[model samples]
Target: MSAKRVDSTIVVVAVAAAIVGAVALLGVLGQAWMGYAPSHLLTYLPMILLPIAFALVAVALVRAALRRRQTEVGQS
Candidate 1:
C-alpha cells in the first residue's frame, strides 16, 4: 500500500490501541478499587497491544523517513 494509506491505517490502529489500553486500565482499577472482577482478555490485552503498537509506529516512522528522503532526492 501507499504511504498515505499506511499512515492513515496507523492512525486508526493507534486510536484502537489507545482505547484498548484505557479499557485495560479500567479493568485493573476496577478490580483493585471496586472489587470488580475483570475478564482475562481485558487483563492481557495491554501485554499484546504495547509491543505491536511500538513495532508498527517504528516501522511507520522508518517508512515515512524513507519516503521523504526519496522525494528530496527526486527534487534535486
Candidate 2:
C-alpha cells in the first residue's frame, strides 16, 4: 500500500473505533439507568466489552502503522 492509502485506512479505523466506543458507553449507561441490579455477571458485561473493543482498535492502529512503515521503506 502507498502512504496515502495507509493514512486513509488509519483515519477510517480511528473513526470506527470512536463510534464503537461511544455506542458501548451508551449501552452501559442505558443499562444502569434502567435500574439493573449489579451482580457478578451483570456488572462486568460493559467492562468486558469495552476492553475488547479497545483491543480491536489498538490492533487496527498498529496494523496501519506497520503498513505505512513498510510502504515507506519500500519506496526508498
Candidate that would win on lDDT = 1
How many pairs collide in each candidate, listed in order?
A: 0, 0
**TM-scores for the candidates:** 0.73, 0.50
Give per-residue CA lDDT, model 1, range 5-49, as digits (tens).
979899679778867877786787788687777777878887788
Looking at model 2, residue 63 earns an lDDT score of 76
CA shift at 25, candidate 2, in angstroms? 0.2
Tens-digit lDDT string for candidate 2 (2-30): 86676676567656655665666676676
Model 1 / residue 39 / CA error / Å: 2.6
> Where does candidate 2 stray beyond 4 Å?
37-76
Predicted structure 2: lDDT: 0.64
Q: Give me the displacement of residue 41 in model 1, in angstroms.
A: 1.3
lDDT of each: 0.78, 0.64
**Residue 21 in candidate 2 has what lDDT?**
57
